[model samples]
Target: MKDAAKASGSKEQTADTTGDEGEAPAAKPKKRKDNKGKDAPHYSVKEPAGYYPILPVQVVPAAERPRVFAYASSTRRDFEVFNRYDLSQDLDFLILEIRQGSHSPFLLVLMYNQDAPDDTQQRGRSFERFKALALPDMPIVIAMDANEHHPLWEREKL
Candidate 1:
């Protein structure tokens, strides 16, 4: 019975010592304080040349053309008629090819009314229709005559 007690006591001591032997020492936790205005001086770095305002063409590919459709009222028929000329051939770059039952690549509705009533409403409806049917990324451009004057027809002052 005494031998058993001695063995048990020695076992307990062994267990306690062994348990602590492999454990690493506890490290002190680092405390972080907000420095705010107490931080070191910071320098304002200048951006490289032409970096402030990025050029649109630099970011946007030149070949990336958005589909556009141009609708013109009778008062603006001249614009549409002019579009048929060779000079107008390049206009396709500004418009997407319209596919039946498919949304236009992009929509360009031209308002050519001399004194058209509710023209803005019509424009809004057209925009909504395109938005509903067009691809999510498709772009829409609305080209309209300013007032009753045609800017393209004006002679250059220079």
Candidate 2:
């Protein structure tokens, strides 16, 4: 709401701020104390329903080339293409290196590999590329969305 109020380029009026029917009117228009005693802010509604601001998305590369990108509210996230580790370059991979406070930075990898038939060479490229990486000793979060149900990961029956 604060972001919206700032975007609208106007102070939050009483009609825009208060939803309570019994709320008292302020002495001056567009001057209302918020919950924290700060000046209230709001965005004008365009229609009868209300104003619905488009949620911001932060793409890592900020380009059309990157088919895989991270979406988050804040654009301060640490992430990159991270294609160096992917020797084969046959996977849709995006990696995020996050460091919180004094904790060690970790890797957040997102991989999307297409499902290939069993015993075929098409599916092994991504796996081989991942195994070839010389990763550091830190927590790694790998999110893979694939249709592979191999027994190697303890999946005997699919």
**C-alpha lDDT of candidate 1 relative to the true structure:** 0.27
Tens digits of per-residue lDDT for model 1, 43-68: 11233443221111111212222132
Cα-based lDDT at residue 127, candidate 2: 45
TM-score of 2: 0.37
Candidate 2 lDDT over residue span 73-118, tens digit each: 3333343212222222232555555566667767777666554336
Q: What's each prediction's TM-score?
A: 0.18, 0.37
Clashes of 1: 4
Model 2 residue 80 lDDT? 24
Of candidate 1, the 10-residue stretch with the lowest lDDT total is 53-62
TM-score leader: 2
Counted clashes in each candidate structure: 4, 0
Clashing pairs in 1: 68-95, 68-96, 69-108, 71-110
Question: Cα deviation in Å at residue 2, candidate 1?
Answer: 99
